[model samples]
Target: MLDSNKDIVLDELNKVFDTIDNSQVDQMVEMICGAKKVFFVGVGRVLLMLQAWEKRLNHLGIDAYYVGEINEPAITFDDILIVGSGSGESIFPLSIIKLAKKYGAQTIHIGSNSESSMKPYEDLFVRIPCQTKLYLKDEIHSDQIMSSLFEQSLLLLGDMVAMKIVQKKDIKDLHLLWKKHANLE
Candidate 1:
């Protein structure tokens, strides 16, 4: 029974990948590789995905941050704001994206629903087809992890982009930071 469920999930994911527009992926990579600063955000489980992206971007020498109340600064025209939303209709994150665009920043939206109205406002959209529990009033359940398999796929996508950034920039020392930061006994 578990295997059956797993197969179902894989099949759904395959469909999602099959339909994805490869050009959109190129747009995302191009934007990230060229952006001076990148800010990533998501409301709930999607936030976890964005957080991972932030770490990877930092490693690649890009300024990236997760949105919060710490007056984290705004994204500029040369900046890219990466947002992760399963539904793409989530209000808070959507609003943030809008504001970022208003400030002249390019936006990249990652979501499970490609048809979301939010896509119209973004410069790049990477859709991961999966049903997300739309909590009442556009809220997200903190307990629900937004389809583990799909989220994992998004993480892999982010990593791929990060690696691309490293290659495009021809980073001089990939492991130098690790060596300096490593806690040696």
Candidate 2:
């Protein structure tokens, strides 16, 4: 029964990814690669996924940091901020994106609702097109509870971007990335 449930979840995830626009994803990759520094912001499980993405970007030798991390540098015109909020109406993320824009940094929002409050603040909107609290007309329905599908898709989207960076930069040795991994553990 657990196996069947797993399959169902995977199938749902597949549909979510399938519905995502590749052009938007490509634009996100370009922004990440072009930025002098990349910053991330989110809340709850969404923030957790952003944290993992920050780590992966670091592993790939990109300068990435989360909003609240210690010693985080000031965002500038050359930097970019990626905000993850499924509803696109999360209070904290919305505020952070506003601050990021105020700092002259480029802002990108990866969320389900394109018309959300984050819209005005963001320079780019990469819609995940998955189930969200708004119950938008275009969202892909999910069997998973709450915003689980959006969070899961957000994590995978980061990975997809990381892989694209690898290909675009022509990093021939995967071992080189291991050098960036935490060794203290």
Candidate 3:
């Protein structure tokens, strides 16, 4: 039964990958690789995905931080902020994006809505048309619990982009990435 459930979930995720536009992925990679610094934010479980992205970006030698962390630097004109909000209306990420933009940081938004309110603040919007809990009524067809597909696909998306960044920088030595890991651990 668990295997059956897993298959159903994977099938749903296939739809999400199919729906993502390649152009948006390219835009996201270009923005990250070009930024002076990169910051990330999201709310709830989605936030976990973004936080993981922060670590991976750092591993790849990019200056990246999870916003609101104690040591995170302030946004600047040369920085970029990448946020994932399934609803595109999550108030927290939206508010942070506004501040980051006010300081001249380029903002990239990842959500399931192209017409989302957060769109106006974003320099790049990567819409992955998956159903989220915020729109459960509109997504009665989804079998999994709220927004699982989006979160799963988000992790995959982030890792794929990070891999590209590694290749672009010609980072062939895995030990180099490992050298950047926090020693406190």
The top-ranked prediction according to lDDT is 2
Candidate 3 stretches with Cα past 4 Å from truth are: 134-141
Which scores higher on lDDT, 1 or 3?
3
Candidate 2, residue 126: the lDDT equals: 94
* C-alpha TM-scores of all predictions: 0.77, 0.98, 0.93
Model 1 worst lDDT run, 10 consecutive residues: 135-144
Candidate 1 regions exceeding 4 Å error are 1-19, 69-71, 134-146, 177-185
Model with the higher TM-score, candidate 1 or 3: 3
How many pairs of residues in model 1 come into backbone collision? 0
lDDT of each: 0.74, 0.93, 0.86
Show model 2 residue runs off by greater than 4 Å: none
> Residues 45-76, candidate 2, lDDT per residue (tens digit)?
99999999999999998899999999799999
Instruction: Estimate the Cα RMSD of every predicted model relative to the unseen true structure.
Output: 5.1, 0.8, 1.9
Model 2 C-alpha lDDT versus the unseen true structure = 0.93
lDDT of 2 at 100: 93
Residue pairs in clash, model 3 = none
> Judged by lDDT relative to the true structure, which candidate is superior, 2 or 3?
2
Lowest lDDT 10-residue stretch of candidate 2: 136-145
